[model samples]
Target: MNGGVLRVKHHLVGGFSTVTLCPKVTDHVREEIKAFLLNKANAKAALQMQQPAFDYDEEVEEPRPSQPNLKKRKGPMDKFVAPTPPDVLKGRKDRKDIFGVCDKEERDNACRAIAKWFYDAAIPFNAANYDSFKEALELVGRYGSGFKPPSMYELRVPFLIKEVEEVENQLVEHKTEWAAKGCSIMSDGWRDSVVQKDIINFLVNSPKGSVFIKSVDVSEAVKDANLLFSMLDRMVDEVGEANVVQVVTDNASNYVKAGKFISV
Candidate 1:
């Protein structure tokens, strides 16, 4: 996520700046963590056994309605915790043997690091559930410890360009399908509660799949049906009006009028 670009008087630099990450944890700390985790596992097992057994056979009775608690809830500030500074990162020493076995201490240290990065970054817990996360770990493991992570400049410039190229490669297949069978111009607008702005997203969909064109901040003209129609019209023109089968948008009053005007 750390990324940026640098320019010398409006021209981009060819060479990338790299950072060598080295996180150091003592062997004593590793032992403490291992012992604590072992205790936690045993505690979890005991708690599961102590739980009350459910009697499904005895109860088919309707549940009683409960009254809502009107008592004042605790304020958000009461539970707030200030963020702490992150520790310096370090790359673990790689094994000499390419197919070497990892010992218990090494394995524990690796797990500790993986969890630490996620926590420090404030990444969503569910992000680990995605297949891409697993694939990324697998790919990185192949290189062992020799991988030099990109500096902020390299990530935003070179790496960013690589990611865009990968996405564009995938979109090419969808564009081919669009030429064969007419595609639908799907669009929707909603207020982004965080940024407090109205934004619209446009996509082209066919039997193959949908490809998101772009997102636009439309807060200024959200209420103007004529402007909305014109925006949608331009999108249709971009995708080729003759090839577009339909224009799909939300049922919001302004959007409905805009869609109707486009249809006419």
Candidate 2:
């Protein structure tokens, strides 16, 4: 009966239990095994949750809108207004008044009136030629209607002569001063109206500005070196060699020779 009871007890124990532990096994070992099994099960569940499922169809993208054009439109008749001519805006009555009276017409009378106005106003007649005078006349006509103009030649010649004389007088006065102090002289010849060749002497003072046409000596043939040299010599004599510091002239052979002679 004891043997039979022992056998039954052993059989029951073996059938109910999976492992058999000896008395040498610790409690910590059992706890470590439980923790390892729990961690493995949690890791498998997290991996399954993180995985993404794939779809086979292509993605549809949205279209971008086009930009609008911003160009400026030009209108017709943008360049049609004509500019006014200078002479018309200035109120020039006649071509002669604007230019000066060349012919002995009504314009000539107008030019004379303009000259008289200038004279009365004490405006210096420095206008170089009739052309310039005509411009002045036109200006005067624009200003006043009562002016009685003179013949263009008549109005112009006297004014020019007066101006020339005044300039010549100033030149002469300066020349005299240049002579008092030692000065140099320069000269050249050129043709004038009526085809007369005139010798123009220029006086240069180191202390003052130079003077031209202070004295004019006319010659029948200005191209003649001997005549020009003779004229220069006479000028040098008048000024005196002691007062005449130097003589400067163009590169003409005659001028070179004259300069050498004068230096001596």
Candidate 3:
């Protein structure tokens, strides 16, 4: 200390301990500080000496068996351990695919492949959440390896045509059910601003299922009694007069007036 006042020097104080300053301790502290500065200067000199003045190939040491290092430096990756997976089927819910028998790497790769397809093909994220999407993947898995997917042409043309035919076949069955059980011709009318039109949806519902017959844009349609009668008459004729047990429509003045004219 200068002038008997304690002037705390950070560098000099490095070698001090919790002991109060005394004549004997002060001398020992001074020697400790001297040793600390000397060691630091020697370390700086050794570092400079180890670095090369010019860039050169590093020395290749002889290959030796690696020994475990107790003083090894650790980072996030070095100490990382895979977390234990949860029991999916432990509670009320069914088992999840994440905890399936397949390797985690394999599952991740397959999921990545599907995700890439979505990105590349511009498919929506909601498509993955669809039940059909799960069913499709399960079907492909059941088919095993070497499964060739349908081409764009098949999806748009021949296969689509077959699908249309199948729908028509289902319609024929619906028609049969309508005839046997007698169906109701239901009509719902609304003004759609999107299409800028007054629309009416015609549905033929039976015990099997409801079938959408057609949507008529009645925005500019003639609201006269004869025209309304003709429309209702046509609808009844399409469903077959005998099969149509009831004709349900909105109680609009024009429709009510037209219904009185319908003999059925």
Candidate 4:
């Protein structure tokens, strides 16, 4: 190492092994040995290179065929041909004559149609202004034929009762399920801001979910505990007394007593 002879010897004495160094390495000899090892490792690495064995798959299993790529296409359409022109626009008189909407019979039909739309859409009956609806129809009559709108009496009185009957039928369908799953009754008292009236709401809760039973107007007798209890008891009877497990109400003293009365 660096022009000095280096020797290493192993000795055995008294069954113990010892290593002896000759011309113990100096700093120059240590640096030379490190450089020689570094160069030898680089030469060994440069002698060989690795390549992926592509045929290894064949040794494992047969090769699969490559799939062809397919793409979606709209395909060719027939060459464009011009279409026939439509009939000319009709004047107001011509439209009235053709559709016959100006006739008295047609006018009544139009009024019924408008009324049905209001009912099915659940538009507020009392809040609606019949004059406003008539004015709107008059505006539509400019391009079309004029129509007579129905009176509020026709829309509210009859349609309201029809809506009630339909809702009752639906609740009847769910009554059996509610009884099977059991239900809770909740009573709440509050003031109706718009009507300026006291109201008590009753609701039924079952595994199927909650359904509103009814709202009682109690502005006159709201503070009467006996009357409140009777109203709630009526609801219990309606829902089937056997189906109700608990009655819930607000912390108000009257409602608290009402709950106790129902529980008993």
Against the true structure, what is every candidate's RMSD?
A: 23.5, 46.0, 29.2, 34.5
Q: TM-score of the candidate numbered 4?
A: 0.40
For each candidate, what is the lDDT? 0.61, 0.53, 0.63, 0.57
Instruction: Give the alpha carbon lDDT tens digit for every residue of 205-239 in model 1.
Output: 99988899999887776467887898899999988
Better of 1 and 2 by lDDT: 1
Best by TM-score: 1
Off by over 4 Å in 1: 1-107
- How many clashing residue pairs appear in each of the predictions shown? 4, 7, 0, 0
Runs off by more than 4 Å, candidate 2:
1-143, 151-165, 176-182, 189-210, 214-228, 239-243
Candidate 4 lDDT tens digits, 135-210: 6554455323323444799679886889889988878766876778788888888898997998889998887778
Query: lDDT rank, highest first?
Result: 3, 1, 4, 2
Q: Write the per-residue lDDT of candidate 2 for residues 1-264, one digit (tens) a residue.
A: 243532333222221132223345354653454344334434533443356332233121111111011122223331222222233434434544644544446656756876897788888777536685667645554334344455788668986788889988876777677767778777865557686656565555546677653656576455556666787788778666677877778887878877777666
Residue-level lDDT of model 3, residues 1-264, one tens digit each, is: 432222232223332231222434364675565455444434543454456232233211111011111122323542222211111112213434544555556668989999999999999999999997987786565343456789999999998999999989999999999989999988777888887988878899999989999988888987666877778789999889999888777798877777788854
- Backbone clash total, candidate 2: 7
Model 3 / residue 222 / CA error / Å: 3.7
lDDT, residue 197, candidate 3: 89
Model 3, position 210, has a per-residue lDDT of 92
TM-score of each: 0.57, 0.35, 0.52, 0.40
Report the error of model 4 at residue 225, Å.
2.8
